[model samples]
Target: MNRSQYLCLTALAAAIGFASAHAADTTVSADVTAKINTRTMQKTTQFDRFIITYRNGTTERSSATAATQNVTAAVSRAKLHASANATAGSALGVTWKRKLAIGSDLVRTSRKLDRNEALTLMQQIATDPAVAAVEPDVMLHAVKDYVAPASASPGGSAPNDTNFPLQWHMRPGNGTVEKVGRDTTSFANWGGSGASSAWPNYDGSGVTVAVIDTGVIIHGDLNEDYAGAGYDMINDSFVSGRAADGRSPGGWDLGDWTNTEPYITECLDGNASAGEASSWHGSHVFGNIAAVNNNGTGVDGIATHAKVIPIRALGHCGGYTSDIADSITWASGGHVDGIPDNPNPAQVISMSLGGDGTCLASDVSGTAIAGAMARGATVVVAAGNDSEDASSHTPASCPGVVAVASVGITGKRAFYSNYGSTVTVAAPGGGIYANDASSGTQVDAGFVWSTVSSSTTTPDQGTSVTGGMAGTSQATPHVSGIVALMIEAVNEAGHATLTPDQIRLALVNSARNFPNTPDHPIGAGIVDANAAISAAINYNSVAPSIALTSGVAAIASGKAGDAILYRIDVPTGATNLTLRTLGGTGDVSLFAKRGNPPSNDGGNADFKSVKPGNSESIVQTTVSPGSWYVLVVGVKDFANVQVLANYTAH
Candidate 1:
């Protein structure tokens, strides 16, 4: 609503320019052009860097020298061009920077290139038989609400448990002027994520979560392990704000205050006043997830007993996608060259950062995410602070991530939350004013209060608690901490940790429905920690029974992300049984098996059917008499859909 929230969209673009090229060299294919434009959001006109993924076993993937040679050849072949302000080479002095951890090459031009020119060059690169994909090396930043410097005053520097009363995002409590001074809003039922309810029950023991952001600094409220506590993965020394050049071991925030010359001058896209205060953003996010509880100081984290491995991905002027990808890969126990192996890999990777554009399958970040998921680490990301469809954001739209949206204390979508079907669930991200207010006026307690720094430019000597921050950044860690609890609850009981897919489904299935209809669809509803923990514990529980050609033949209702299970008993001499779902205007996936429930992974199931709409069928020609389990997961919301099983006995 304010100028700060638009920082991700309008403020990130810097000075623009154009290029001179033949009309024939102006574009790639139409489809590719459209995607490139979408990623840029037309907000950014300058592009000088690119991330190129080459197929495995290819020469480019194996040899960095070979990769650079390929890009140079592409520039020459495509009549390489730069932005209006840049024209310094065969292609703006195209130079290969480094190879990414995911086996992708990071190439930089001498200067910026306009969108079309960048697209034309990328198209040329893709034309290589070994090239898998290539695109701009996009920048992703922390997603906290942008507060104007004048309004962002440091709150009480109290190092005790005083500010816990104002943490409405953690538990249920109506906001009133009497309780929180100068806040004129009341919602009798302020149903929060049930995190506190599960506190006395589960404390997320023996689980490590990777907090990938600006890096968690020294704080009294936060507990970080010495070994594998994460790293400073930022590649550029200028963006990192660290005196040393190479990424070091400590994932500490040396301060990313971007009001200086190069930072201010470069960050001037649409934002005239782009002087942002150093947030200590990573520490804030870390506090929300796993800050020590009952420590007689500050606030309580959702997963009180969980440990955080803060992976520093963003600093100064946001961060590069390649750095974030490397952090993700290393955090989840994957390999990243030039960086030591993480001794303590996390069970969940909490990312409160992202940038414009939906994730392409070949995106380096998306590929890293898939790798993390394959390692059984649950990845959670913020939907974004830009109040647009989350489908337009990275990580959020990426497959295998539990994308979270923001809800206010009243259980409505936050004014700045990005929404859409991509969001996996919602959590309290705080609204400084009433939900109807486009932009918040003035209310300190209405924000998501947590551990923050007092100094605007550098470390404030010690920590402070400020009730002056809110966004999908706050919402994401709540879910991550809960996931930690879920993992702990299951693992502490001597059970193997749930797979990332199963964990995602359990979170989706256990969510309590939204109290009010959202303007756009946002997963199941506000996340319920109590319900989700129970759901994880009972994930493999026996399925409810239904009769095939005997009694109740149909189930008529479902919501997206709901994987409802039922079983049917066939009789002796049974010839065949046909199970199908129809009469619905929403997407649904059907899976069935005789003895065990089938996985709805599109494969790995005994028999499955996944078409477009609710019309899906699984026909077993040769059937045996037994309890046959069926799993019906809503790919989209369904109203009066009927899931029925028919049989042929001869």
Candidate 2:
């Protein structure tokens, strides 16, 4: 395997970080530490960055100084090298090597190797002239992988369509007008001037969405309109199997959303809490994405025109990994062997809640998420309510899912929102607790203005008692709703069905870049639903052009500002062209100029810090049908590099 790919595999073992304060920290302690100290790994964080220790007395540290000219780039290279070297070294050192991941480091060692031998090897490596310093390879507590129960039935037919529309597309047929409440921050400021004018047609009709969260209580806004029958993944059975009517519970659950059993009025908050507060959290989230707009009551929804397939997952401190994984797979109509297919399959799944943990791409949760995507489902998740960046939680951190951050009404980031380049976009998740205007707008209230559950009928229950709330949890559904709207527009416009990659491109390309905010906070600006829907309807169906450059140029892997130039002909009035890469971090860039190539010397390049996946566009001004030179540059927080230098005419 290539060096990076090798690093990726090694890193997979350490995919998850600390799950909770109560979880186990490591599996093998004394021997692991002894081995790490024996083999010298990099000492300083600046020079070493990452260190890997194996059971068979092998150690590896990233050579931060030996990589590319960029210091940061070198560190990244060193970390990868450390992992690769450690694994290969362990393979050569012992009869059987086992891989272990501690936080971000991947350590490999022989299962049979004794602690004394490990210590000796470590000491030798530490003293070596090439060695820097070494430290104990710590162990991390994470969820163990759960084995799927054997399927009761044989394999069924795989889905035929590769691109399934987001579920909110089915809302229009539900018969309700769009809701326009007091708050208008999310829809506004998405684009340069305002929201796009694309919501009039195909307002999410016939599409089915799955929302996995706290149980939802049946409410007027939902049962009256926009609600489709759903399943209870936590109960480990179909909706019919779990409910008296064979239908998933719609509103408020005194019982935990994680466990399928009945409510136990025990040691919870009080009489009020069964396990966790079964408030209308999920109901509000569902409404925001597909509440009937112009319903003449309550707030407006992003897509007042779609149907939803609700699946509950939260409860009792937190839910179990096994249940969450099963729900994710089942929601996508995946073959779990024993479980019946979800009565209503969802094309789009939105996870508005998350925990503080670092999970790898191979974790059980990650695997399930990937499986759902493989089945052509669009997974959208909140980065987390926690304010830390890399510390952001999983399901969102999973490779295939689109991780969302939170923004507020004023076009700024929410204080409780997590920020990272890995995040895709920022939606209106509201700000921190109420303080004042000096502390930024208290958007938490205004952010979550949508339909709520009516399960609580007492004075403290129902809409009067349990009202809509806000958080990254609430912001996620807005994007989900918009995704549904865009899918509908795409179908109505008669453009070719878009793949997840294409849908992602449309969202990023059309997103509003928040130049004034921190790059980590807002991501590729806010998700412009209106603009996204418009692009979906009028998508550029042609394949992106790829042509290599004639001369040498630097192509940095992570940087977002570097440009690679190539000559190509431009069609008359061509507005933009897309640049794509097959490997690496899936980064992209855009460039624009007025005239034809050789003639048009004045041009500009816009570097996107994070990889926007398979394809992205360089929106250009009007140009004559003639030859031109276009440059696609790679950029990041540090340097500029080139990937492929090619030009294509739209």
Candidate 3:
């Protein structure tokens, strides 16, 4: 068919399909094709216009207007290379779009173009004298999918919230069906990171985690945890506004619903399937990480005490990678041209969105991520849901990032989860595809439940809606929350904040072994919250040690109440086991115990040396073959506290 005929037919089909699906509140997928040439009617796909980065020191001011003028002039210069008949006004059909808010020099095109056209335009734009580099704007989507069950009901139970019980991913296994014919009983306690166990000690207070995804909604359940107005990076004038381009304050969900009558006509490349109901994705993600707890209303979040800095980068039909990259930089307190300096810099950045490409150091997202890491923010990303090797996805495949894969309540890799060497750990991402085949539709029992909203427009516009969502998108926040808990623990212990590498190591090293082997190998097993907190609190030095026959000795130093850990071996028939603390002006107490230390402080110690002053002594007459732990707690701040242990061999 001719190009005109093809466009007319595609629009007609899309309109009919959308009308039918709209009446039923259902979704339909359709194949769309566009004629690039007489021989090539390629699939109508999305590609960003040329994004050109100018060399540093070329522009005096990094404002949007300044960047726009510079790029416009460059485009004019590039037009000289166009066909001799090309007019200055319409050469290459390129128009100046807004300058990127995150990167000062980068500028985008005014309209989306086909991949080949965008590539050709980029090549022409690269010839400009001022252009340092140019690349196509790659599209990224929210790493979440909303499955509308045949008969769905909000499930979960908390004292105040009625939907806490449905959140099986947040608790130990509850005998739910996570996989076909498999009950999660074997992995009952393997879910979550034992976050509840660490609740009493650290609720993630005084920590900020930036949720970089679709904008968040203001749900009642998230009120206390909401930090403040976050920036919206969707620069489309139609979606946001002309004045809001580059960015505007307030991270609000503007309803991503598409495919309806009027909206279907605006579908990219005339594809109807690209439209979807508003996922409220950012709200769900943030809710999983920092929903208010003990409020007598909703499900508890893993890091209830932590606040979220919601930065909206994804919108209808997903978002552009350039916007997301900027959000990452700005959220981590990096400078972005148009936006004001961030008042609250996030210590952790949680990205539950990704695209289908390997991350390259030269790419915009990679550069932004590196900046965030340099600022000491721990980045957590979702492994794609394509069920392919995670190495094929960006951010997840990026170096120095904690790429989390999804696991069902059964402690196995979720059927839809991507896995491979790129995965850093696994968390419960919910899989309700098994067991009760009542109506043949997967039930809501196998999903992560979190805060949401009913409105398709305005922030916090509709009644609060909390329900279950399944994907690596849901699994990502669990790790982010656990990271918050780890940070809180480390901060409370008066230790230096952990670097991104250290935090990644602690989580991987402390993950619980999987109960059963998974179809794909995911990270170091599922994340263990209690264990992660323990690992963080005892990070670098201060770790439990083994005592030798000559009596392993070392000088422990820290602020007041700091605990130094040591262990001694007791051979079979061994008798004397002596532990002591000496040579310090500050009072230090010694406690001896066996096995792992208790989760709480109330647990009893086998031996205690509580002296009124600086020195402490302990001797155990009855010692047997096994490992024993000695805890040296500083009663007062001490620079050097000598810790010594002696155990007799059998």
Candidate 4:
């Protein structure tokens, strides 16, 4: 359809979405699709955008022309008509836009359709044996909790970024969210992502991070990489609210303010004044990842030495999953028809946008992530702001993505952050409330400081300042930048490039323990940038195991969820060699594998010792002589952990 309205997910309507943590993953099964349709349709009755996929090897998937023709025939069979038109042969005025990176088709219609009408139409389309899946291209917004910073804040201290003191979220904290009226220094180091500490040792040099959101506006503090692969992905003029009908070169933000004619009514609730300000969302997220340092302009980014590639995927009333998926593929050096290949392929893909929906591994966006991972790019996404379990959202729920949950300076879960087992880590997405009390008054100091333009509706790049915004949207880039640092650390150490799995494990093992345990599971813990860099360097090393000789020796001491990595070069023909965690005060598990390091996630472990306590050993399988990697993961708060490797050379 030509016109579309932005509809908040079932939870965002009331501001506090209490979706069940047990929501099942999205599937093409009739029952689940029906459930998803029913829930989605309740938000709006109008539509125009949709994403349809045909199974590979089908006639529809044969060529773009063939796919379009078959879909046209299917819609004609559905007898869909243009809005307010009674002609049956109108066939809903459907037009195929283009093919997405995951082989899905982006299609639009001539007019909006009500829920029942669209459902019936989709059912008819799905009846085609070639059709694999079809769903409304629901809007995905920036996942920030936007409560304006209370104007009563004082200024910052040294580091000369002008607003460094306001950036408490970047430094290490004393395990508390300092309330208002306290001296700035008293809470200057509140628990945060530890970017400041990490920067001293690792600067994310030679790494590139893709900010795949509202695109970017090169600001005073932000560097548009000399060879950046930034591009605008918004193909729908209606969605973009711009004059351009198709994609373009620069991924600059032409203002996504929803106050204009169509967006005022479509994205916002008709009230023009209720429309949101142009969030400069992508710029802020980018700044969080790689804004320049020592420039004395605005805020300091996490990875100061890293270059950024801005990939515009969301605009106006948010964007479609199909477009976002294509962005993931493109940013990671995967193929996307028509668009130029990325000159600076991202080492990490950071997305702070998501819509509420289950994303199965086989789904469009899920497969796109898999493709990016295969190309050695780590995907990091916001866990959403609905305060519900992150499992209910796309991208975040997708397998292998680093789903980040928001935690305020105190290191407690932000009231608006999505949590649960789906979260990969927690970071500084500013908290709006006093001490994170949802009902209490909001404070000014809680915002995660970053760079932004002065304009509320578009690009005013020259007039930039240290602006602040909150949400997992802001928290996401923290981890993305840290991943860049980790990658750089490995490179600096002259080791092989880290696989996505290795990077993930390094984050998990190096995460700082939550100061005060959260009410819900946020992640392994807040990411510790310094620790992550160290962990990554250690995990990638091929050096021999330092303490694991023929006899038992202390391996490492750590708390629950900590992973200490070690490597042993098994001489040729060594057999019956056993690696085990023999002595530890608390519970720890052993995971050993050949060549690759295994993580606690249990996906890459060739041999595992997963008994109740710390006395875990791999005795069942005879070891072959090769370079063996070993990891000791804390099952509980453990200390005095010791490792023993008993083997005989044949």
Candidate 5:
């Protein structure tokens, strides 16, 4: 059955009080409850898939065949119970699916069994002396709500990109007509502050951001910025409806739309109704982060010059957490069996996909994230769209990842966005229902526009299209793009590449304050693209040389037109303090300030030296008993200058 037919049935079911609200857990109907009570529910015994890790040196062999044989031997030794009449190979059927880089195996039984029966079988298998760890292959769905939208136009001020007008998240309200109802007062001049403003200075030229989702489709806007076709983790040939064996080389988006028949048979369990459309979710997310810039056709990406490393993990009906974990490890330059090393290791990994669960160290997804962070890849994830605390979700709840929440054009918490202390920041994810009373209908005015496809089929899909989509899925990429810009700025500044923690710090410190305080903290604030870039560019050590008594100190204000800040502690009863710019070829000015520098330099300065030439001085008979700041400005583009601070204290 098609999705439309399924939706009609679902609406009818809802009217009859049969279907409950959609959530993470499965909903059971009265009929199913009666069947279970009577022990009449069809009990089928199916082989359960398990991810098993063997003891050290037990499964890691020179060849793939050897490793498989060793794992099989270990399973055989466990002597799991099976039917007495079963054939040799079919009895206790243990088949190897794949080898993992972390010395584990994806194993499955050939027999079909019920859930309880399968659990019993797995428990017996786990007791094997050779088995180090084992877990059922749990499924994880894409964390986004995929709704096909009506037509819409791009809105922003970028001249070359025609779709810029639709990109409300990229620019401030510069009195442009396109930004009419977009919370101009609160979010005005806040858009693209750190990110878009830094474009001319640094466009993430040398950085690579990995989009780990349903894979990326190369559109006109994203073609030129492609780093390469990354690896595909969904090894199923039937999933993409293409006859390809094993996990293929290229990261391509095969449609993930579910038909009504399957939605009823599998998802709804012959009771529930409704199906979903193909999201082309990865493509939309990719466009937000690295779509080619100034391309006449579509919207401008935040990190226009950065190359995208497309890594396909989620596929039909979402994906298994095991596959998602493997993709994360592989994307961040970790080793994965059967695939070649990732040539373009990502500096920033964007995961707009997640599942409902707390992140634990024992879980594959959490372990993979830790590995990615250890390798210095900054991971940005969507704080789930459940509108509940994000701490209940995996990946977002995982420690060290930048969990992003959603806000609308009004600069308020998006009604659907998940909140909690776990969220690192919030970005424009669009809230269509803000103005409209209609709960679920599309509103063109309140959405994030990006690249998408109109086709719903596997082959001969629709041509390139752009429109609005809303979710934490949209917010995740905004932070990813900003991080790309930050990384670029840091690299250009001749500083060592920033670690994941440092990048998070820069983003948190540089975020803009929220217009209205949210009930729960979304993050430091909305991510300021311009401020984050500035933070990255201006990152310097806070340590200052201690001023000594009767000494000539030499220092160079690193760059022209830059301010060098210095601090000195004036102890009690200290006397005769003098600070001055002694010599330099170019004009240099000095100021003695008591507190933070004000908007203008006039009121805050206790003393200022604006001499006619390259020298200036400030002297005080009795020094104050507290900390004092010395500000040095390069008036005439001075590269190096000499300064002296002499004091006599008893």
Candidate 6:
């Protein structure tokens, strides 16, 4: 068909989309010899005019306006052309490009419509017999079109969801939202004295978590106890400093967003002014992630005590995969060859940016991400804002990372938040599309409120300070902070050297599941600092109940392994206990050494002395019966840092 005729036919098809539901099966077949290029059409529409907005501010777009055209005659010509093509048998098959909605008429008939009425309506529409079929309009989540909540003042009488800590909604609040502000947290009321609340000690004094995003703007909130800052990986510059090796800190009055890659032309027209505006996105994200929680001046962070490693990655249009890969490796303390070691090695890496889709085996980004996991760093990635299944996003979909989905204060899924089995947890990331302006009640599904850039303290750090912000980017820091808390709790309990897996499990098991969402929507529910700390603090030793006929606790070398064997049983579900191990500098090992034991201790001889080959029982392995207590003693190993000397008796 001619171009004009084809355009007219397509328009007609669209106009009849809904009306064709009850039409007769009048099929149209055509055969013609023309080379069709599907790929060209696909490419043209791939990223055609996508809609995006500034996450921090608002923008307006006018209603669409298109010039109207009349093509009634053109449609008739296209129909004639189709018939001619069919008769010629140029193409044999009937190609049904559009699947007409055909089930609505049947559904309406089954519902309440009288048979005669349904038939009458169908006949009227199908009289010409050109209509093939019709169906109901498919509905969607209404994400893009959904109106967003209005912004509210930070100080308000009503308990606003935004005012709550980042992951507070994931866990039921200790009380109501109104009471959180009144609590004496470092973030809420820094340095104020009161009885210890849930996370009484969060001053990340010794631990460091990495914030891998746009570089941070060194604001007062983060710099209060800021131990140290690192370099910008996006452009090899020291974080908060002008240049990578420049000794001086960044200059004052710098904005948050930096322009590492300058544009050739500010605007195509000469009248436009040149400036930097996009660099602050990273600074804003970091400010929320680790802006000293409860410093008594600015907003509260999930971990007020934790320190951060700012690994700058994003800049310009978006960060490159190579740069991001390098940042991830460096932050995790992995070697990048001759480069200087990361001054602040993070135990966890928080990445708030992500691209769409699942990772292919050949995906370079996915492979590099795995490198970070191998280095013992816990990675947290954001499920994108597309609201589609996360199976289609990279980095987030990459295995060995925790995928975070957004939730609002009301505990509902944010309309735009993506979800899937890959999601390990959910947090409050505010949605901007829907809301009540007067009430400042935005959809609370995924709103995570935290600090953002207010002004730039360093000329080189870019000129941004602290301010209010929200996003999964904002919510993720909450999880990172909880990880920091878990580390702190474990360290305080004396297990300062915990494996990544142990830390991950403790955090996951202790999360608070939301009442409204019971499944994959919120991975294991929201993060709970109090529950996690409680579990870590009360860890205990257990004795296995498995029966053994006989076993010997052996010890080799001069290390403290050849000492104790005391058989003690523990009750089920019990979590606290005290046990004795061989003391003093002498090499001695304490083992509950599993196996059947002699009916009785060899009286005083077994208790005080050791036979050449007989198992020695020196230490008292004490605990309630039924729990398993095995060998635990400090032994010197030639190769390993610590080794199992031999299972001895206690």
The digit string of per-residue lDDT tens for model 3 on 341-403 reads 788889999998875555544456667887888899999999877777776577776656888
The alpha-carbon deviation from the true structure for residue 577 of candidate 5, after best TM-score superposition, in angstroms, is 48
Cα lDDT tens digits, model 4, 534-645, are 8888974322234355544655788887767776656534677778786758998888755334544443466787898888888634554434667888889988777877
Q: What ranking emerges by lDDT with the best candidate at the front?
A: 1, 4, 3, 5, 2, 6
Count of clashing residue pairs in every prediction? 6, 54, 12, 8, 18, 89
Could you tell me how far off, in angstroms, the CA of residue 75 lies in candidate 2 after the best superposition?
40
Off by over 4 Å in 4: 1-42, 83-89, 150-159, 174-190, 226-228, 540-650
Local lDDT at 222 for model 1: 72
Report lDDT (CA) for all predictions.
0.72, 0.44, 0.65, 0.72, 0.64, 0.40
Model 5's number of clashes is: 18
TM-score for each candidate, following the candidate numbering: 0.79, 0.54, 0.69, 0.78, 0.69, 0.50
Model 2 spans > 4 angstroms off:
1-198, 223-228, 236-276, 432-446, 454-466, 541-650
Which candidate should be chosen as best, given TM-score against the real structure?
A: 1
lDDT of 1 at 8: 53
Q: Report each candidate's C-alpha RMSD, comma-separated, in the order given.
A: 9.6, 17.0, 16.5, 10.0, 15.3, 22.0
Which residue segments of model 3 deviate by more than 4 Å? Answer: 1-48, 57-89, 93-104, 110-112, 126-132, 148-150, 155-159, 173-189, 224-227, 241-246, 435-441, 456-461, 541-650
Mind sharing the TM-score for model 2? 0.54
Point out the higher-scoring one by lDDT: 3 or 4: 4
RMSD value for candidate 2? 17.0
Model 6, position 427, has a per-residue lDDT of 62
